[model samples]
Target chain A: MCGIVGYLDKVGTEGGNVGSVLLGMLTALACRGPDSTGVAVFGQHRPDELIAQIKLGENGNGTEYARKIEETGKEFGGREFSQTSAYLRFVFTETNDLHAFITRVEATGDPVEVVSVGRRLEIVKQVGSPSRLEKTFGISAFQGKHGIGHTRLSTESVVDLSHSQPFWGHGYPDLAIVHNGHITNYHQLRRRYEQRGTRFYTENDSEVVAVFLVDKLQQGRGLHTAIESIVRELDGSFSCLVATDSALAFVKDAFSFKPLVFAETDDFVAVATEEVAIRNAIPGDFTVREAQAKEVRVWSR
Target chain B: MVEIDAAGRTTREVNRAIRQRIAESCKEVVLRNPGARHNLAVAILEDAHIRIAGSAGYYCGGLIDGPSIEVEGSAGWGLAESMLSGTVRVHGSAGSGAAAAVRGGTVVIHGDAAARLGVSMKGGIVIVAGNCGYMAGFMAQKGTLIVCGNAGEAFADSMYATVCYVGGEIANLGTDAVIAPIDAGEAQQLEKILSTHLPATLRSTKPAAADFKKVVAGRKLWNFDKREWRTWQEAL
Candidate 1:
């Protein structure tokens, strides 16, 4: 099991230090998933290009691998690839051709995954504790209007950077997914998606959900419609947070076995796997309510 | 003698400050009017003598270890759930599922406890001064529950190693739970344990009034039935 939290605002300045709020929420949920932590902050600047978080080897080749990927960006028309020790942040220019570009990159030996993407949405993630992610990526540095974050516990998949969430809908800008439960039908879905030329990097079932939702959204479905469609088709107990460039959506599985709580106010809206996460993210006296079964709620700024 | 008034502070700030103090320089801490502050406290104060003046929300002293915690008021659901070690005392009533999955330590509720007390307890001692709701001591593998008052019903359903002592009437004993007489030696051991964990107000009461009827698993559920068809034909 994992924990997912997201916050969006309709009025007021949503762009103020939301990174701290996201980090605080992730910290509250650290016990749910201790393997890795990640956060995506939607900044106010250029909203077209999405930030892809990639982790290279720890043998001092992080920067070199990032430069190599940056150079490879020329193949699919990407730019501005930056590198750190085991961290890579780059902007993809050709959003439409991002799927093809990601496919080519995964053919290489090095592991890579699109952690999050959105209009001005920058994803920061790393292996280890939530505190480690904050320390390594300076996740609190990014300020945005609203964002989604995740803390991963490796129940089914190996504990690697590639399997960490929230996974970006491959090639889709301003689209990201964070899941809470296992997808039992992952093998079937993976076969179908793979046959259609979709490349998968991790053995996690959550990645299939991300790809499925993105496929729906890219095929001319709205965020709410796409989420509702997946909720009906997907089998398993899951609660997910999907974010687009201008929208934030939550979808609970049919059974609603997994826990999800939300607190909405006039100023901001928050959702988390547990009520404690919502309390940690927005520190105020507010009534937290549990999400209804099979409910799909959406918020857009 | 560090007294932290958590009143008017957000749960986060209170938790952060209390955790910091516990980490830095505090062995014993006291919180005045803790009921007004709604955050998890005993969770952070492991191995410390922490006293709460008022009631606590869910999970008071949950997963506690080494620390001796006392709550002056009642406790919400799942009190001491999965508690590993140490002692937790609730002066008033406890909500449902108190001490669920406790591995060790002792929990004493001066008042009544709701349903599912000591559920799945691996080992420990839980003493309820008052009556308990239904399904008390369900799935208890290794532990002891002493109910000074009447036990509701279905006591020790699916119980294994745990022993239950009921002072008053028992509605029912589910599955393999069987009532056994408390001998002189067992009574002496119970008295000793009660003296250590119970408060003076409760300990002063006459032991005869609280004389308990011990309940334990019969161990019959572990084996499979292998009776032949001839036995059924003879009975017919």
Candidate 2:
């Protein structure tokens, strides 16, 4: 079982100590999953630049991999912009074909994991504990209004930075998902998406949720509708947390099998697989409520 | 009673300390600032009295095998979830899934509960003093859900074998869910479960407790054998 957490600072605490606070939340869940860790930070973003975080493994050559990423993103007028040890951020214009550009970039690859794509999103994940990820990726230095994180045990896939969670909803500029529990119908859904040329970066079912949600939104559906549709279409026992540029939301399968608790106050709204993450991240006396099965709630900053 | 300051410690440290202390069979440990941090005192198997001074975050006293845990204030979701045995008392409101999937134990909530109060409950006794939200006992397999106040819609939909007592109005019931009379044995059971387990303020007399309408599973519809499956379509 993995740990999933999401936070939205409603009382103007945006761009505060989200990095350290989220790190503390992830640290609280270290017991749940220590194999790999990830966080999709919603840092301040300019509207013009659509950024994507790529984890293609060093490939024995950072320059070569980085050049390959740059080359792959040639469509959408992709530009080589920033680099970190964990991810290469590619900037493109909003006018690009979000679906086709992300699809093509993913198809022509050494199996790169596009963690998240959004104007404000920056996903940092690694093959280690929460502390290791933070220290290695400088996660403590980040400041964002809202974000979602995951700590995984890797029961299905091999442990690696690429297989880490907080899978970005490819093509959707501001969408990310962190889920706990299995999507049993993953293979069935994957087959349909594969036939249509949707590239998958990991064997874990959580990634499929991210891709599915983005595709739903791409069809011009609102965020809440897309999340509600998940309970109807996705067949599994999952407690998932989603984050957009403006909202942070959660949805549980009809079984209520997975545990997800949410705490809200005028100052902030936080959720986790357990209450400790909410308390650790935003220590307060807020009452914690479990998200009901097939239930959905969205918090906006 | 021992007191812990949860101000700066992570859930790991706090839970570790709790587990370690309870393992030593500490008689009483009071947790301070028990605000919404998760997995506090989870899976404690001791019979100790672990009290929380303020509101507790998610899964407070979760998976507790045996303990006389008391929270002076409200508790976040899934309070005493999957509890094996013992008594957990929440003096204030509780979030969703208060006693969800409980196997055995006595959970008493003095305040209202959010949705799915006892979803998938297998066994045990859950008593909610105030109203409970929709789908209170969704898919309950076995056990007793006692709601003293009104229950939201679909209270016991698709239930298996759980006995539900609704003292107030029931918005609706799901398929195969129907009202049953509170027999003398079940009435005594309710009275005993509520009076003996609840605090003095929540206790009610036998006659008053008998005002509830009992809800049980429609067992005949659970599974259809080959013989019944053939004629099931026309029977409806």
Candidate 3:
């Protein structure tokens, strides 16, 4: 089991401290998955470029791997590539040609994919405790209006950084996914996506969900419709959260094997795996309700 | 001794006072007026002596460390939920899910307990003076539950390391569960436990110690069966 939290503040308001909210939410869900934590902040910065979070192989040379990623960024016309603990965050100047960059990166030796990209979107992830990840990445300093957080407990996949969730959708900037539960039909879906010129980096079942949702979004479907379509098609139990620069959506599988609770007020909307997370995130009194089975809810600020 | 008058004080205040006293002292803390009102006492004591005069609401003496809590009246649901250590004694009946998920300690119920007693228990000792409800000790990882009276059906389902002692008839044992005769050593252990926790009124006319039965889980259920028919037949 894993913990997922997504926050969206409607009404286009900015001053409402997002970093503190992420900290509180993550703290509440610390018991769900205590191994590693990650956060992606869609800040109030320039929302034109896409930020990709890539996790390379562990026990390898961090600097050498980062240099290779920086070279790849340069080739794809992206500027300002940064590295942190086996992770690479690249800022793409031309978000329109991300598909070409993804394809070109896949052609390289090591497996690489865009983890998240969108206007004002920046993904910060690491391989440690939530507090450790926050301390290393300065997640507390990430000032954003909306974002998604994940705490992973490896069930179907290994505990490597590449298998960590909040996987980015191909050709979808600022679109990242976090899931809790197994995808029983992941191999079938992976095969179909692979046939369509899509390459996978890890053997995690959760990646199929990201690919499936991204496929729908690329087919000109709205975020909510795409989520609803997948909720009916995706097999097994899952409660997932998807985020882009402007939109945040949550979807529960038809059987609703996983747990997801949401607390909504006029100021903000918070989603988490447990009610304790919502309470920790927002101090004010609010009613927390469980998301219905097969329900797809979308929020945008 | 703490004399909490529930005449006007809220249940929360009474519980808080008791909790504060338990946290501060190692001496025996007696709570007067156990039946005065409904209250939920959580983390009442880490390591002290506690006595309640009346019924306790949800989660009475929850997560007790080394202290002993004696409830004069019945207890509500989730009694002793996730208790790490200590002992809880209920003079009256216990509502559903008694001792649910208790990690360690000893819970003695003088009266009957409702369904799902000791569900998912990791480790502990539970003694019920009267009958027990259905699905007792379901999915129990480890612990011991001694029932002086009849145990409801479907007891010890998916049980791992827990040992169940039922003095009277068993309605039914769940999948992979079986009943075995209690040995002399085990009987002596139960006698020692009964002497320590059982009140004089109930212990005076104790039944024959050799009549108790033990319930255990068979290890055959751990394997994954390829054929559905084989699985169903073995389960039956």
The prediction achieving the highest lDDT against the true structure is: 2
Candidate 1: tens digits of C-alpha lDDT, residues B1-236: 57777667666776676677778768877776454223456565357777876666568888777787787766666788888888889887776678899999999998877667898999989998877876789889998888888776678887789988887788778777898888988988888877777777887762552387899987765454445444334222
Q: How well is candidate 2 docked (DockQ)?
A: 0.33
Which ranges in model 1 have alpha carbons more than 4 Å from their true place? A45-52, A57-60, A74-79, A92-95, A104-109, A112-118, B1-236
TM-score, model 1 to reference: 0.59
Model 3, range A1-301, lDDT digits (tens) per residue? 7889988877545654677688778876776787667777787655455556665545334566567777877876677677666667777665566677776654544644455666676666656677887777777777767888889888867776677766777566677888899999898889898998887768889888888988898889988899998777789989999988788889987645576767678888898876556655666544454564566899877
- Which ranking of candidates, highest lDDT first? 2, 1, 3
| Predicted model 1 interface RMSD | 9.0
Q: What share of the true interface contacts does candidate 2 keep?
A: 0.34
Clashing pairs in 1: A14-A145, A118-A174
- Residue lDDT tens for model 2, B172-216: 776668898777887887877777876666665223677998888
Model 2 misplaced stretches (Cα beyond 4 Å)? A58-61, A67-80, A90-92, A99-113, B1-29, B33-49, B54-67, B73-86, B92-105, B111-125, B130-144, B149-163, B167-177, B182-212, B217-236
Each predicted complex: what DockQ? 0.04, 0.33, 0.03
Q: Of the candidates shown, which would achieve the greatest TM-score relative to the real structure?
A: 2
In model 3, where do residues sit more than 4 Å from their true spots? A11-16, A45-48, A106-108, A111-113, B1-236
lDDT values, one for every candidate? 0.75, 0.80, 0.75
> How does model 2 do on interface RMSD, in angstroms?
3.4
Report chain B TM per candidate. Answer: 0.89, 0.90, 0.88
